[model samples]
Target chain A: MPYVTVKMLPGRTVEQKRALIEKVTDAVSETTNAPKENITVFIEEMDATHYGQAGVMHADKK
Target chain B: MPYVTVKMLPGRTVEQKRALIEKVTDAVSETTNAPKENITVFIEEMDATHYGQAGVMHADKK
Candidate 1:
């Protein structure tokens, strides 16, 4: 099964995440010709201190 | 950091996914006020046979 993980900052409402998962799943299914039921999408929200990018930690970046 | 999983069908160009990650990351960062570096995103692709939804396996749904 396709298990998709989306990590980003927090503060998203449940509705937003639900819409995102549905839209993303549909997009991937249509594009790849895969079954919708097999698509598994998950979202993770983290704090600035937990992530790092471009040689700078998120806490430091912001 | 937020760890997001995006499970979808395969066969997408790397560029499409790269853009997706960048855009999604930015959206989340701005919306949640989280740092960019802390966001961790991962994508997983699975065969129809490996996934199931609505009481039906993807292989059967397809």
Candidate 2:
């Protein structure tokens, strides 16, 4: 069972998300040989205030 | 790099989220021998409508 989760900043449209889910499902299915119906894709969105990189909070960095 | 993500139905308070992150970090650090500062925890919330099991979506389950 391959469960793929996409973590990204919010602001994407519904169409973008649909495409992302479709493409990721295809890639995962192809590489892992998991059936398309068996794969699950979860989209998780976090704002800049909740993100950090290189030991610095994104909100604080801004 | 063990990045931990918790996906659950929303409704927890901010304090609960803090505790979740802290405890998850501690557990991961202790088991993986990774430094606390090197661990990252992300909280993701999804609604029942977005969840499914056994070919039935949660929203449709009810």
Candidate 3:
């Protein structure tokens, strides 16, 4: 049982999230041969301040 | 390069989140022997509606 997590910036609409859940489930199921019903998808949305790159916070980027 | 994710209900304040990140990073570092700076921790707060257990959504539970 493999759980999938999609981490991204906030602001996606509910419909987009719904689609994302469906599609990612399909992909993971196809790739891993796991049953679709057994797959779980978690969407993790983070604010800019919570993410950083190369020692700089995303919120600080221009 | 080890990445850690903590998924839980949404309620903790920023101070708690800060401490969580710090402590989890330390734990991962100590166990994996990875440097503190090389460890990345992501805190994912999800609504109860998004989580389910034993074929039931958490929001539906009494």
| Top TM-score prediction, candidate number | 3
User: What are the candidates' individual DockQ scores?
Assistant: 0.32, 0.11, 0.12
- Candidate 1 lDDT tens digits, A1-62: 45667666666788777776776566556544558797677776788787777878778975
What is the TM-score ranking, best to worst? 3, 1, 2
Better of 1 and 2 by lDDT: 2
Q: TM-score for each prediction?
A: 0.54, 0.53, 0.55
Model 2, residue pairs in steric clash: none
List runs of model 2 lying over 4 Å from the truth: B2-62
Candidate 1 local lDDT, residue A41? 72
User: Can you write out model 3's per-residue Cα lDDT over A1-62, one digit (the tens) per residue?
Assistant: 67988889898999999999999999999999999999999997897655543333445565
Candidate 2 per-residue lDDT over residues B1-62, each given as its tens digit: 56776778777776566667667777887898988778776666789888988988887866
For model 1, what is the error of residue A52's alpha carbon versus the real structure, in angstroms, after optimal superposition? 1.3
Worst 10 residues of 3 chain A by lDDT: A49-58
Error (Å) of candidate 2 at residue B6 is 9.2
- The regions of model 3 sitting more than 4 angstroms off are A1-45, A48-62
Chain B of candidate 1 vs. true chain B, TM: 0.78
Docking class of 2: incorrect
